[model samples]
Target: MKKAVLINDTTYDYHHGCEAVVSGIKSSLLVRGVEVIASCPVGVHYKKMNNIEKAIQQSDLIVVNGEGTIHHGREKAKWLLEVSAYAKKYNTPSVLINATYQDNPAEFDKLLNDFDLVYVRESESYDYLKQRGIEAGFAPDLTMLLSQTISLPEYQSRNGIGITDSPKVQEGMWNFQMAMKHGWTFLPVLRSYRAEGEKSATEVLRHLKHLFTNIGWINKENGVSEESYLRARNRFLCYTVSEYLKKVSGLQILLASRFHSLCFAIVTETPFLATSGNSYKVEGLLRDVGLSSRICELSDFDDIADYNAYSFSDEEKIKIKEYKKSSLIKINNMFDKLVGLTG
Candidate 1:
């Protein structure tokens, strides 16, 4: 069996949407009969370069899960560069899967050139890399592929809104308040990892301290000091990707700020109004699906009602279905070439 090492931004944290991306990549590799040997988070794995080198030496391929990691942020991008360098040194084939780029194009060109193949999750990143003279192909986010196999639970639609809260946007709180004032049964959804798999007692305590400290202000504002208001409102806390998708499928609409929250909305066909966060991933994705009008900036909260009233057209649904088919074919073709899989 051809051995592969799967590296991602965070693999063990189930709370983050990237966890689902990792799962999807691993599933795709396994379906191709590749033996996945090492799976580790980039932050923790980069500290032990010697171990990474050893793993690369033993593996036939180095598969990096580049889900939105190649942005202006120095940390994750630096880690990917180092990993690519190690793969090149070991003369092992490497491929970056389902990535997006928002940083220095020249730097990305140099880094991506080291990989044998590069697959981006959206056109913006694909064009960015191609314009920089790097050969990159476009593929949909891996989570969409995973969602294809998932069987969502049948639930009666309550016609209520679901709100995903992020610390990056203060206006998200106002949106939440508005939902409550309107008596909408808004489900609070958290797409961030909350350290649920920490093994050490000290680590657990540290995570709890961090979580409470961050959300304590919101609790105070709501006059609920005993527990976090966000925590109390969260309907999908600590849920696996499958469970989260099933839960999201029941919602009538979604108000999302996080990129993956928008992905879930798309996968479930749940109409959503998105607020821009730290990156253009959300806007780029909505534009790709012909739903650019669905994007609402943080300052545009006053127009929330207009956003809520928006619905997907039959033509848009048909477009999404066609996109999903073509995207999956691209991914499957990549895997077949890499692992020599016959289907």
Candidate 2:
């Protein structure tokens, strides 16, 4: 059997979206008859180079699942640089998947040039890599693969509205006002999980450091906690990805600033208004599936009624379904090529 080492540095203890992305990649590989080895599990630091190198050496292919992590100066970028370097030194066929590039093109020259294939999830990153003379392919986010493996729950919609919190956009008050005006049940979906007393002292200290480092950006007076702004809503927060998906499936509409919240809405076939967060990840995914019309700004909240009225036509739904199929095909074809190369 073919062996593949999947390296997603955040899969173990990240938000449900991260878990979904990792699971989607693994499911796609498993169905293709590949044995998977995850390089980074929760609580294990990526600095463990010996273990990572051993896994790469034992695998037929190395996959760097840089899920929106190739941005400038981010810790994930540093980790990618390290792993890509190891893959090169070990002479393994490596592929970078579902990554977004926000750093200078020059900084990524060596890493991008060394990869056997680079699959970017967003058009902006694709174009950026292309302009810098890197051969990059554009594909939808891997999370779309979840639609294939999971079935949407059957729930009666009571015209409920779901909203996600984002540091980049503070639309909590506006969303709450709209929910009240429309008499829709308000749901706050927490994308990331916070462990109360389950973490070690070092981990807790790291989290506290992050909280204080970004204190200016956090709105404590608005009841937005340091952990996540969604805590302010505190009404109905879905902790797990499954819960979030079921909650979104039941909602008539979602006003989401989190990227994965939008992903869940898409998978659940729930209509939503997406606010662009700190990056183009949200708008880029919508544009890829021909749903750019759903993009909304904070100011657009004043006309929430118009957005609530918007619904996807049967043709549009078909387009999304077809696009999802194509995405899975792309992933499978890439792996096939890798297997052929390694074989």
Candidate 3:
């Protein structure tokens, strides 16, 4: 049987979006008869893993889940890229997929060039790789590749808007306050299990930390207390990812700040309006789907009624349809090339 090693595997990360990406990648390979022998998690030193060296040495391929990791000269990016070098050393084919490449060090070009193929999640990264003379293709993030695995909603059944978390506290504050001001749902992109009832002492401490850290912008308000934000946040917390996705899908529109939330909006064909994320990731995604005009400034949030009439254009719908269709085809071709199957 053909064997493969997955580097930067994020299935265990517990973020619903991360899990979707890993699951899509894994299932893609599995259906092709590739047995993934070793999956090195994010932040782990791929080369130092005791069994990893042996796995790659005997494997037919190495695939890196470059999801949001290969930019800004991060140590994790360096470690993950070194897997390609190891594959080169062992004469095994290597591929990097689902990446957002932006403002990265020029040295990364050399590392990227080592890959048998590089598939970025957006065209900005695709253009960057092309300029640097690397073999590359661009597709929707792997999160979108899971669209077939779930149910989507009909337009007539959807109503209201939802705003989700942001990596930036101030951005998160804007989302939270906007949802409250507009009487919209504040969906948390972070997944947590609530079936166990009371959280452990450790989880309690984490929630305490989450509360304190989340209070930074709220203190400026006259009547808001530290616990107020935490209490409000908990009210809408979801017990499962499927439930969360269903909630997002039911929205008439999503005012999102997280990259994955935007992906969820696209997966459910929910029209979205977004703000900046930590990087160009959000803008890049909107650009990919031909919805670049949907990115709004904070001032635009003042009147929720303004966006009440917002929805996808006929042209934008076609662009989204093309994105979904072409991304699936590109991803299929990517794996065929990876495993040396006749394309």
TM-score of each: 0.82, 0.78, 0.85
Could you give candidate 1's per-residue lDDT for residues 1-343 as a string of tens digits? 6788877745444345776677667678888778778766755655465665677788888888877777885666767755777787777888887788776546656877787878888887777777777787777787777556755445435366666656443444565555555544444444334333334676456445544444324433354422444444453253346667766667777777667878877777777778876556776777787788888765554345643465667887776777666767877787776675221
True-structure lDDT of candidate 2: 0.68
In model 1, what is the error at residue 168, expressed in angstroms? 1.0
- Among these predictions, the greatest TM-score belongs to 3
> In candidate 2, what are the lDDT values of residues 58-174, reduced to their tens digit?
887887787776776565566675566677777887888888776644666666777887888888888777778889876677777777767654644635566665544346655
Q: Indicate the residue-level lDDT of 269 in model 3.
A: 78
Worst 10 residues of 1 by lDDT: 189-198
Those runs of model 1 whose alpha carbons end farther than 4 Å from true positions after fitting are: 45-50, 152-158, 167-180, 183-238, 299-308, 340-343
lDDT of each structure? 0.66, 0.68, 0.75
| Worst-scoring 10-residue span by lDDT in model 2 | 189-198
Q: lDDT tens digits, residues 93-137, model 3?
A: 888888988777878878888888888888888887777777687
Model 1 compared with the native: what TM-score? 0.82
Candidate 1: clashing residue pairs, number: 0
Candidate 3 segments whose C-alpha is farther than 4 A from its true place: 153-156, 193-235, 341-343
TM-score of 3: 0.85
Give residue 49's error in model 2 in angstroms. Answer: 4.7
